[model samples]
Target: MQNKSIGLFLVILILLSACVPTKNIEELAVVTARGVDITEDNQVETMLNIIRFDPEADSLFTSNTGIGNTIKGAREEAADRTSYNLVEGQINLELYGKEAAEQGIFRFINGLIHDSQVSDTMKLAVSNVSAKEIFNIENPNMPAVGEHLDRLIEIEVKNNSFPPATIQDFTRVKTTIGEDPLLPLIGLVDEKPTIIGMAVFQDDRYVVDISLDEGFLMNLFLNKVENKSVEMTLPLQPFEKYKINTIGIESKSLEGEEFHINFLTTHGKSNTKVESLEQLKFKTDTYIEINLTEMSHPISIKHEKAANLLEKEIEKKLKKQYEELFKKVQEANADVFGFGKLYRSKTKDGKITEEEWREKLPYITVDFNVDVKLMHTGTIQ
Candidate 1:
């Protein structure tokens, strides 16, 4: 009776297992990154980085390309060239070519939004040249190109060096009434993928590219700045008046030498105000506390006003930079700063369309008030 009972249990277990379906790992091609581009023939080109399950492969992943009418169609063509089933559930990054971005990215992004398998946290970037060129790069140090780029952007965003541009973030900005979208721009520097700048977009169309310095300033406006470092080069002529003469001191001359300072572990906050709704004017007050980590030349700390003067110089330089960056955005007619949100709130109906806001953007005036404080001058006596 005991043997019969055990035999019946085994039969039920086998029946339950047979009801489920499974595929061998070798039969799956797991995609970690995808690149989309438009060919000269106007066909959609798709590049995929797939993880290899075979132990005999030289690299952990391989890249392949396919051209078709649409992103889905292109990938289907790529699948026909491989025996393994192409799976996109693990995709960590998606890149768009310059031409695709210029033509507009909403159509491509719409497909991603509807895909149930794609993760909301997947990162998106724009390639300065072509996605195909980026995928073709072979770096000995980076065996897995997709994984390397994924980790690179993650670390840079965490360090506050680059803007956060995940799919979720992009969707939020795109759907928001008063804001525009920005993406990280990737380029090939010495055959290695590098974060060159931020790609500014006006209503899904690529407008302009801003340098990383300008991107950092944008980060200051959008989010709190903490644990960030900034390097500045100042005119050394002003520091000549503050120089001290020590009997045994031997220092370089201030003539034709630029003052370089590195601010480390900075913390800052920014507050925006609608100065005049009718006049289209706004004001932003920014406060920052910096730790002076390194300096090209030393100033006499015996004077009580030395630190104050240094702080003032930094404030002046930063304020100018902010103004210049704002002017660039205005010229491009892209309101990446979200100033329109303030204007919209003050409207009588609290309604402002993107087209109306863009028309008002060029004439909008902003006053940037920057205050810099030197909290610690590391060992620079």
Candidate 2:
């Protein structure tokens, strides 16, 4: 009886194995990155960076192109070009072209949201040029364009230079009332991919483009930054008395009429509050501990009075930058800072509409209080 039962079990195991579909690694085309662009004729064009498994291939990755009226259709068209099964489960990055971003990104992003194979943590970015052009870029230094771009944005976000922008992050902000989404803006500089700044979205449309400096400030308001850098050019006339005089030594000074100081923030935080809803007044308190990394002219940081002067100048400069950046954001009516969310939270119903916030954003005022602490002089007095 035991021998008959063993034979039956073996037969069942063999039948189950034969019923399952088998996939070979060498026959699978793994897509690492996807780029979406709208053609001049208003058709969807999808470019995929597919990993090549053949050991004899010239490169580890290959580009596959397809065009259709929809993303899924384009992708299916792409699959026909390759003998291997096209897979998107490994996609680490998604990029939308300038045209697509301007038209609206939610539609392209919506496809990803419904697909269970794609990870929510994958990074998303907007390109100033066509997404196809970005994929075609050839940089010997960047053998894998998709992975390189992913790492580039990852490093910048870790340094607090760029804000976190994943598919999940974007969708969350889009669904939330009184808040908007922002993504890293990438462009080719000298024929090489580089981070231009950030794309500010009003709802799902690309409404405004902000500079890298402005993006850093947005990160300060939205995130806790461990390291941030700011460069300031001050009038040399104010520090003329602090210049060192070497006796009997003739030298040409490198400091021009303008004195430049570079500060590296060791820690940074910004807190915002609704001072008055009726008056449309808000207050933001920003505190930063910075280290002096570079100084064109020597001003003794050891001296209390001189250090305080430098701190005050840094505070004033940062405040001015924040105010100017906020003004631009307000003009575009893109609430990337989530100020409207704060307003909603303070309301009786804790609810606000996009149109309502847009109408009030232009009129709302924010008082900025910047406090700069000189932490270290970086081996310089």
Best by TM-score: 2
As for candidate 2, its clashing pairs are: none
Tell me, by lDDT, which candidate is best. 2
lDDT score at residue 336, model 2, on the 0-100 scale: 89
**TM-score of each model, in listed order:** 0.92, 0.93
lDDT of each: 0.86, 0.88
lDDT tens readout by residue for model 2, 1-381: 999999999999999998889878888889999899999999999999889797778887888899998888999999998888998888989999999999999998898889998899999999999998898998787766778789899999988996798899999998788889999999999998888999999899898899988898898888888877777887676666667757787744546787899989899999999999998899999999999999877665677787888888778888999899889889998888898999999999887788888899999999999998998888768
Error of 2 at 20 (Å): 4.6
Candidate 1: lDDT of 104? 87
Clashes of each: 0, 0
Weakest 10 consecutive residues of candidate 2 by summed lDDT: 245-254
Q: Candidate 1 lDDT, tens digit per residue, 217-260? A: 88888889899999998877777878766678785566566888
lDDT of 1 at 162: 60
The collision pairs in model 1 are: none
Q: Give the deviation of candidate 2 from the true structure as CA RMSD.
A: 2.3
lDDT of 1: 0.86
